[model samples]
Target: MQKRPNKISRSRRKNSAQTIFTRFMLIVAFFILWIGGIGVRLVHLQINQHEWLAEQAQDQRRNQVKSKQLRGTIYDRTERALAMSVQAKSLFADPAEIEDVEGTAKKVAAVLKLKPSDVFNQLTKAKVENKRFVYLARKLDEDAAEKINDALKNTDLRKFDEPRFAGLHWKEEQKRSYPQKTLAAQVVGFSNAEDVGSAGIEQSQEGLLHGAVIKKWQDRDRLGRVYDETELEEDERELPKDVVLTISNSIQYKTEQALEAGVKASNAKSGMAIVLDPKTGEILAMANYPTFDPNRFNEVAPESLTNRAVQSMYSPGSVFKLITYAAALQENMIKPDGEIDCRKGFIEVGGHRFNDPHATKVMSYGDAFAVSSNYAAIKTALGLGKDRFYNYALEFGFGSPTGIELPAEARGQIRPPGTWFGDSLASMSIGYELNVTALQAASAYA
Candidate 1:
């Protein structure tokens, strides 16, 4: 009751109250701004970039699995598989994840019949280079890979609790198998470890055989458990079409056998033969000497792997006389029964002298053909002259490839009349000077 407060004391008291209120407001404002900043960040991440964040998480959770990307089955006209793709296993390892590198190399080498030193060197190199994928073995048989997996499991090399093994891993791959072995080796050809067509039909029909790789989306957990699988778009998914050839199995086998015998009996360096349907002109069988097995193509020499029927060019010999006879007969230059002076199996043309196997003073045109008379053929070609001779050969598909469905086909060489030497016509009449393939001659005869 007695002490009335001084102005200075009241002022100090009000100032202190004001200071406390200001500090309290500042703290509340600071907290509000901080919380609002956090909320804005959450909105941006959740709404604006939701798909991007989801993809990032998915990338971490799922593993991209690449398949063997095998080619389609190659079947004969009868649906017998000549070249086929089969399921097999390939072994690989992550250098970073591999523990006991030397041990892994030795153990795997023993099972795969690979040199331990080679395996060890490769693994060590991969580790030093920080490589994630290294193939230990490729295109192994299913039973063979299982043996390796068994070995790894028994030694506790594969850690079951881990996301992936810290050791060897197995991948399913497609391997090319030739069921008929060397039966149609050159015809079917072969593919490499990567399933690439190397020769023959395999190389020619690579587009249809080697289908596109399908990248499928699979949601897998850390333990490799499948959560969900997304269907690939129809456009993205490619199923290789099976290739059916016009080759017949029975005819092919017989042709090969006969050709083999003929080659051996003749004691020739090499030979090639083709069997075709005269009406259809479809290749029933194509055989090559010293043929190789498509299954073991690597072990054979390159020459054996050649498809000689359409690739090798040689003189037609007496076979080409058919063209000369046809041209002469069609032009009515000589009748089948007309007599011609063979000059005792020798004839002179353009300062060149030619001899025949059958020496006859005078013989009918048909008799001259039956005896394969070189003199008769030369005279016949000269009678047709350079222009008619060249035209007849051209009409028979000479000087060009037959355009048969095969790889590395060869087009025979033939000079036009403008380029022909004086003796060129004579030589060509007997299937010389010009080049031709076994298939070409066969087709002409057909």
Candidate 2:
């Protein structure tokens, strides 16, 4: 019995040791497989996926911008520059390179005098969408751009070797500049940042003054520093044509100075003047009161933009008598020295009395004209009849546009004899029953 118990104890001890050894071997095998799997994954990523990840990182930091060629210049008759394009700086950003977007946006806005919330929203949207580029400001002034550069360098957040923030950057662009701020403002007009002409000659000659648009790309580094740059190279043929105006710069200056003084002295609401060559009818100078600078056209009153010399219409008053006298003289209705009676200083026509402020009675046509006698003019027009008068009126270019190559030219008003009242001819003769622009009256006599 004692020998059997000793054999059983030996067998149990042997079985327990075998179970313990098997358990240790299984644990070791599991650890080896886990480590080997990790190594395989590391190798695949390094060899196969490296290119794709690197491309992604590069794309995140890459910056590209569309650039345009400079526009053609505008010169006066003497080849003096009235409007030209100058190089200006524009601010931009890349959200992918920017960290702490909210904080960066606040600083940018404060320095740029922009709305903080606007900057934050734009930056946040770009970051969420993984966009590479965004514009912060366009066509910044020299002082303004310098202020941004100074702020970046002097800020507390700047490091010794790097900028205070990422994504803030600047690029060159063309800005329209006018040397003569208010001179010929209405005639010269102005353009917008899109290189589009909005008013005056700028609007009319858009095809000639606006240049071509070309794409230009510039590469930037992670800290928002440009490493590679490209520029727009254009020959004269590819650029827009420079415009030469008929206006004389010296004449324009003198005309504006005189007009401004006259308007101020007269205390008039507004006024305009145009000097034209009688021989060729070429306009030398056109001026208007209450003018605005093209550089700051946005701040002017809307009424001031009107080119009143061609647009506004008013009755020529006593000026129409010249037309009547010439028409009567042409048809042989009266001679320049014919006799007319204006002793009463007033005459009755269709129960309405018309008075001559300064009248001479029983005078020659010459004397009547010299005195501006209303009676003599009325009688002559009646003798000619409305039919002949209407023909002469149309011949004088009344009731028609002058075709001045200017915007909004007004066509003066004239009624046919068929539409006239019994006294219409009389009123027309005295310059009362018709509308005429200043240009029309001057043209009639010219």
Candidate 3:
């Protein structure tokens, strides 16, 4: 039995040695394949996705922001500031860094006077989505922003060692402000919350007034605190050009007061008045009734923001009679002291009768003009004929824009002599068929 056992033991030992060797070889092959797969994955990550991964990582700790340069200041002829850009703070938050979303929302709502529930919901959504930037309020007033900053300082988690609102920050921004408020509001126009001009001169001169856009990159800590800021290299920055208007602040104020009073007393819907320097053709004052404050332009009707002095077109009425009388006198068609019969207050033309509010049997040309007698004007214009009258009107700068540096200036409606109807001369003489703007009227009188 001992001799037989010896032989079996030797065979079993040999079989065991072969089984261990096979297992070692299989393990070595499996490991080699595993290492090759890992190497391939590393190559793909380093080569293919390097830029995207780097950007992803950088975006977490850095932000690129656009900052608007200060808009040019608008001044009156005397160099008094009308519209200007003021430095202000715009509040924002990094939602991912906001540890207490509800608490932060409440604090922001209280400071900004916003709806708490709305702010809370927005903050919650942003946090859940891991948003990095969210604007809470823009262009806050100095007093309000100072109060918010004070509150933040007092409740700072790092400074006060208390659980406080985090991820709250502010950026510098330019806010368009009209220190004169309603003064020259229509002429100066207004810029909206986004610093875009909406009306009047502000819109017409936007290209010159708007400053260059500045771009910057800012580095932030894990808590979203901006620690460093660097301006990115760009093309030359153009400083905004200041606009110097010929408007007189004193005259504009007085004119507005007078116009407002006149409109209210006359029970009129709206009114406009323009005063010009006769020698220089410079506009001294332009005033509109029911004018709005440019600061609160968004709260008013768009129609109310219209600069009626240049934008509105209307019949010149008796005002146009000066042109007819001048044309008649200039052509020697009628003497300065000549008398014309009113036909007892009415006259007929093309089956239409034109009446005179203040009429007499016979009156001097000067008397006719003084009383604004429609019959006398029409009679004088008829003597000048159609061609002469139209030419005179064109010479007076009617039927065309005055070329003032303002937006939406109406050229007015002037039909050609060929388009005139049978009674067109009579109608035009009394200023019924012709249209003109207030600025045109002022220029003509000048």
Candidate 4:
């Protein structure tokens, strides 16, 4: 019976052959479909979106021409440049290209006058995917930048000591330089790392000073010699226009001297003075004690960096007598020689006794001013009436900025006439209650 089974299964053998062939054909069809899908995707990426993808790839490596505007120069009345830009180089590195971050940072530190940690941090900040370069240090001297460029040569261990390892590729960027450290720092102002002005005349005339820089498509060879091929429009490289100031450097120096002496003598926290050409509105000299140098402005105290003569308002103390006396005389309430019998230097107004710091008896208006008698001045102001007196103070330019070309000018305050009663009127008359700026006092005197 077993011998008969060997010859009886021919149909079964045929069915088995068909099943194997069907599976083989199905596997071949699946492979063909997979290959066809891959080909279609390759065509879509290489041809359908080819231009846009090529542009994106080119943006990552191709040399791009960027126009850099040169910032304007500032000059004193003497036509000497108070502020100007000088060429400086910013150092950059490609972290992916750096073989040893720690060692490279040390070499950069040696050349750039920077900390090793700082350079390392800056180098590491470059995005691994998007960044081909990153700035290591900005505004470095050419000599230092050269030293760094040289240091990048040699192997990781030998580069610092070797002379030639510094030739690694890095991009150079332009930096703005200020020669004078802090002279006229508040007035001349400063530029950001990008060379944009933040304050003062630098801010006021920023448009005029920043000149046009022309950029055109350039061709480069293996030698990296960039040459312009096409007449890509006239990129006129207009230098920044110069700004002339009304300030006199010599007079400014003298005023600084005077202000320092006065500040020391008064033992005050801070002080300022401004001298103006009474005829013209030009500020002859504006001085603030404890001024900061413009060159290293970030190192100075923010308070000291302010031009107090323009930005501060003080009580004006005895200096305000000039305004009070002028108002009284103009209103015909008191003559220059008018006598006030301020016996014992005490006057009762609304139950408040107004007295001078040092007492005086009867005095003329001129003598009252010369002595700064608070009682006599109050008497004059009371006689003049608050309405007329307040108007006169306003007319004299108190409670207003002088409209000078400066930053942060403050307008001093005078209480409204409606708030003026006996005490306030008397207090204001003696220069005790009123707030006035140095500029306002000078203007009233002028």
Candidate 5:
């Protein structure tokens, strides 16, 4: 009976141990399954999340800028169009969408008057697989652009059933034009490809020239057809205001004719002439040698862009006598009949001999000026002293800008009285040793 009890006890213990072992194994298996599931989840997060996350990141990075497309028109005094933008077609393409690049490029180039090989290379070289858009040309005329659109309509280049190019990217941009051509080539100036003024009135009035250009975001389809977003605000196109100038065409033409003749006759490198109405400060005429036609400005040399009238300086020759005479009269240092001797046609001042083109035995201040007697003028200037002469020169607008609306006008020099050493006073009296612009001389006379 004792042996039977022990055997039963051992059997019960064995069964209990087996049950615990099975439970332990099951718990371990469940732990393994949980760990495997967690690892698979981690892999999915690391690998598969990037594409969706990257797309989200790109969406966040996308920004829209409201670009403006506004421009101003330039007009003459008569309200004629000198420069303005016109509606034109800007040609573009999707190279990857292009099936027959060579054939299409040939047709496009023929219509555009561009080289076929060049066009083919440009279109094909953008990308071999996935480029969406590339520009071929801008500002095509209506006729050529229409023909291109017609061809695109009938072609098999489109990915969808609709026309491929979406009827050419026709948009209006400002184009510079000089209607009168060379009438005021240097004055009106020219605009570059970007419609920015480079010089002349165009440069001075750039802010007025480029008004504004507003652009709104547009949604594009798979075929690249564009439509304005519903939420986009409307902005009216504001035309640029016209500028009235002090320049006149009639006198400008006459001056140009006279200047061309003078430039040829002088056998000089170049020449310029500017005629201003002194009473009103209006520029009646401004002309230069080797002038260019603003309409065909690209054909001209870069040097022709300069306006020589305001930019040049000369000695002013005998014309400066008026300044000396004016100084003497204004200072009351010499009357019109004031006596001065020039028998030997020379006078010694500061140990320097000054002579005149004409000999004056003895002449009055009036005769001295009438004949441009250099010696008599020198004596008179020396008597008037340096301070009065220099002061008068400054008053007449020497060594200063003429306040003309042109760029780069020269400021002629009048040496200060303190700097007038040795024979400078004597030489300056005869219009030597001092530099003056023609504009200054004319102002002095006026």
Candidate 6:
């Protein structure tokens, strides 16, 4: 009995030791896993998520503001301002800083002719969303802005003192003005709200007209209040250069009036007219019907904004015969007094019959050209052959843009010799299949 009791005590002691050893191993494993998890989290935060956390922290205490300089003025040859930028005011607010949103909205609405309830809603929404800056009005007139400024300053007055607008502020902005209204609108083009030119000379000379952009950094306090606004000076800042066009405003007006009258009298859909100084290749005037005022360009159709003189392509008709006759004369294939058989007033070539409106028989080359006889021109072009005619067309600036300082100028279509159809020569002789811009035709005549 003593031996059996000793055996049982030894077995209980072994089991107790085994249980303790298992618990110790489990605790050690758990501690190692916990340390590993902490190390991995530290590595992710320090390396992978470092930039993202840093940006979030920086964004809390810094803000960027953009200040725009005035865009350059566009002047005519007489130094008359066609387009200019005038100093104006843009109203903005910091919703977080506003004390009484309703009062401020009502006051601003009264001055800006806006709906008070709408303004109030916008202000309240911005505040709820924690927006720092919100625009109330952009590019207000100087006089109107001054009135608002005066109202804001008169805080001691009975009406002004009760509902004070705390965060309303005005910043200097530029508004583009066209002094002459619709005069030379297409030639001068128009700039958008950001002072970027959209067409005409404005677009072609965008580099010279666009001004330097000023960047400013503002610091904020712990409460998110902005302070210490600083402008960073850039070495590349350059004052915008003005563009002086060769267009004459007076002549442009006269031409525009005449074209308008003519189109109205004839009941035409639309018309275009261009005046140029042959001696200097200067465009004195370019006029198009259905014009729009640059000041109100946003309200007009896109088609009305096009400069038709350089943009539209049409068959030159009789105008192109000058080139053909000149080519024939230059090539010694026909003389000024050379006679061509035009008694029939019509001729057939490449299975196409071309008819002349003039009812003349045999006549001199000069007479044929004077009457614009299609038969004479076709015969002359045929005699000159396709190669010489094509070469002369290229030399006369056909089938290409005139390289004018205008946007969207069309390079009139001219098919190569290989692409020419069997009746191409006959059709092209009197300007049937060919296309040319008005500027190109004028340049050719010059």
Residue-pair clashes per candidate, as listed?
Answer: 0, 0, 0, 13, 8, 1
How many residue-pair clashes does candidate 5 contain? 8
For candidate 6, write residues 1-446 as lDDT tens digits: 35445888899999999999999999999999999999999899889999998898878888887878888999888989999998888888889878889888888888778999999999999999999888888887877877777766645433322123477767678998999899988889998877799988888889999889889988888744566888988998987999998989899999999999999999997888888899999988988988999998889999999888889999988898989999998998999898988878778887877777783778898998898889899988999988999999999998888888889999998787788887888788889788998889888887
TM-score top scorer: 1
1-446, model 3: which lDDT tens digit per residue?
Answer: 35445888899999999999999999998999999999998899899999989999889989898988899999999999999998988888878877777777787787778998999898888878878778887888788777777766644266221123467777779899899999988999998878888787888999999988999998888765778999988778787989999999999999999999999999999999999999999999999988999988879887788899999999999999998998888898888689988858888898899877687668899989998999999888888889999999999999889999898899988798999999999999988888899999899889
| Higher-lDDT candidate of 1 and 4 | 1
- Please state the error at residue 252 of candidate 5 in Å: 1.0
lDDT of model 1 at position 157 = 36
TM-scores, each model vs. reference: 0.86, 0.75, 0.81, 0.77, 0.72, 0.78
lDDT of 5 at 269: 74
Which candidate number maximizes lDDT?
3
**Which pairs clash in model 6?**
343-361
**Residue pairs with backbone atoms closer than 3 Å in model 2 (clashes):** none
Per-residue lDDT of model 1, residues 1-446, tens digit only: 59876999899999999999999999999999999999999999999999999989989876566564668899999999999988887788888877888887887778778999999999999999999889877888877766666665643333543213365677678888999999978888998888889898899988888867655677877655668877555565666778999899999999889988998899986888898899999998888888988888889998898888898898889999998998998898989999988867687777888877595678898888888999888888888899988988889898888998899898988888898777888999999899998888999988
The alpha-carbon RMSD values of the candidates against the true structure, listed in the order shown, are 5.8, 6.4, 5.8, 8.9, 9.8, 12.7
Task: State the TM-score for model 2.
Answer: 0.75
**For residues 1-446, what per-residue lDDT tens digits would candidate 4 score against the true structure?**
35555554888898899999999999999999999999998999999999999987655444656556556778888887788876666655656666676787788777767899987776666634557667666676678766765655555533322234432354334555555455566777777777777777787677887756555465555444555443346555556799998888888878888888988998987877777888986787777778777667667788887777767777877777677788877767788787887677677786788767645667788888888887777777778888888888888888878787776778999989887665888778767677877777877877
lDDT value for candidate 6? 0.86
Cα deviation at 187, candidate 4, in Å, is: 2.0
Stretches > 4 Å off in candidate 1: 1-53, 68-70, 154-165, 234-238
Alpha carbon lDDT of each predicted model? 0.84, 0.81, 0.87, 0.73, 0.72, 0.86
- Report the lDDT tens digits of candidate 2 across residue range 352-395: 78888766558888878777778888888888888998899999
